[model samples]
Target: MLTWAGLLTVLAVLTGCTGSTPLFGDNRSPGDAIRIFPEDGAENVGADSRIEVTVPDGRLERVKVTRMEDAEHGQVPGRIAEDGRSWAPDKGARRLGLAGKYSVEVVAVDGGGRRSARNTSFTTLVPADRFIGYFKPENRSTVGTGMIVSFDFNRPVRNRAAVEKAIRITTDPAVEVAGHWFGDERLDFRPARYWEPGTEVTVDVGLRDVEGAPGVYGSQRKKFTFRVGRSQTSLVDARAHTMQVRRDGELVSTVPITAGAAKTTTYNGKMVVSELHEVTRMDGRTVGFGGEYDIKDVPHAVRLTKSGTFLHGNYWESPDTFGSDNTSHGCIGLRDVKGGSSDTPAGWFFERTLVGDVVEVVNSADKTVAPDNGLGGWNLGWSRWKAGSALR
Candidate 1:
């Protein structure tokens, strides 16, 4: 048994050995000792700005950055410095959105095994003008082999290289594809050759807040897919007065046809079938030949160009003219009944045709179609087509 003085002495020695004075308030929890770049509540940060954090006496365990408006969050991938003192977001994650607020959170652990967290927010600079690119063919659409992925921009892209890099094309059974800029307003993508039949194609345009020029920014983030259908191409020989149709490279039919007359000859080159109709109106004035003819309900019309051009039934003309003569204002005319009978040449052709079918005009007196006239990129040589690339 120990006396009261001895027991008090033992208790004092034990307390002195085990006790620790609290350095952070009364709880002894480690203080948040993180140093963040672009400091807290920063404004007008650059779109390409990066986030970095340093812990003098600790190591980072996790970091996250999120867009405030969309709540889109991404984990910041980083590795501790060899000395284990500093951390930074990956190089690829430096592309922040323009005119947007972002929230950053970091959690770290100290040498004592106590966890600490710090959060910061920032806003990116906003530009004066924003541009967007509208794309086609539409999502989930099944089109023929001649279909080209096209993009039309609302504003001109001066920095063509930057814009082109932002656009991406992918195929399931991968094929090499390239993009060509047609002026500053249009961009088109296609393989060196036509897409293989039944190929699945996907387009991703990640231009959101991309700086296209000094004051012009891009504002589009889009994804769309299309599938290629069976192959079909038609050859229209104006001099021979015939149209030869082929399916999967096999000659299927040869029908007599009348191309445009001498004064208004049809454009000669490759064109894609963009639209088809069983019956539609054809007004000469619409194609710049004022009041020469206005036939309502023309049968089995198929549109070939953005400008008024079509392969259509001509019931007003005598049937004999189709096989032997070329007499019309810039259109290919086939013999057919007024109401589009299935047995007629025009009806038969329309029924078998799908949007994106290729039509090439040969031996015509007219000059070759302008590359931008229709889907006429095929008219350009491979070298010339590649020369139009911004990346080239």
Candidate 2:
């Protein structure tokens, strides 16, 4: 339909307008534009290392960092810089797993609206030995004012400073608290004074990847909370052979009691009720005393020390022994029936007591209770307690 010259002109115009563009406009490949940290095939990467991505000439549209073992894939919340070229994971998001293999996928779009994708994988470092800390005052428990947050480590932490720094404690009304180390395997935290009634405390152990020692790494990351209940403290005067119970600082009752005998005296210090049992067996042979007594049904017993000290009912002792004579190996004795009826002194006291209630024993002939003997941390002077802190 057109002349040959005119057809040639049309072809020349078409070639000039679209010759450089292949089929679709600007079909040239974006060609590996995105850069990812912990580069592809990276080994021995830190667990706490932040995953990041940057585009040389584009803006990040989507980014995902997934643990390979769990296949837990989700968009990693990230913040793009003002220039829209650099991106990093959000601060408040959950951290990556420890000793894990991860896959990072990124999608980016340049100013021309061309999309480019990058996929990479890396592995976090594996510790030679993993350590963990078991914390107490169980999560969501309601405890007495004397409750202390204690941690028993599975492995001895040589880098005390690093381990201590990873432990965090916060309170509702806000109190100054400190951690005291008991040797290398135990750490306990408490305020200078007893916890305020009705206060809520939260503990965070962020020990993952913490170098607790050479070639030893901590791998525990957990959070727990506890509430402080009403204040109740019982004062036991060994000289007077009685216990004065107080609630909210008011004398509620004075109960007749008998403490440890003259030879094997009860520990003299502030102690916490660590546990309670309605009926349990007590054997002198088990506590280094060979066959002095073995009661199979000791009733209404409250544990006070790790070394087998208790405030329990002694149905075997005569009624006159209590409030009149100091007798027993190294425990406080209360009058009770053999079967632990609720009406007995031991049962009544046990019903009213909580695990964290404080019991102070005075005028006893024995040396003061060791701070680590039970929940007897309060016996240590404030200066001495703080002196045990690695941070100090």
Please give the CA lDDT of all the candidate structures: 0.69, 0.73
**In each prediction, how many residue pairs overlap at the backbone (N, C-alpha, C within less than 3 A)?**
0, 0
The 10-residue segment of model 1 with minimum total lDDT is 10-19
lDDT of 1 at 200: 95
- Identify the runs in model 2 with alpha carbons over 4 angstroms from their true place: 1-128
Return model 2's CA RMSD, one decimal.
30.0
lDDT per residue (tens digit) for residues 135-177 in model 2: 6676677899998888877678999989999989999999999
Model 1, 125-226: lDDT tens per residue?
Answer: 655587766555666778888987777676688999899999888997899887877888998888888788999987877898788877888876867778
Q: Please report how far candidate 1 places residue 130 from its true position, in Å.
A: 2.3
At residue 41, give the lDDT of candidate 1: 60
Q: Can you give the TM-score per candidate against the true fold?
A: 0.66, 0.67
Output the worst ten-in-a-row residue range by lDDT, candidate 2. Answer: 11-20
Model 1 clash pairs are none
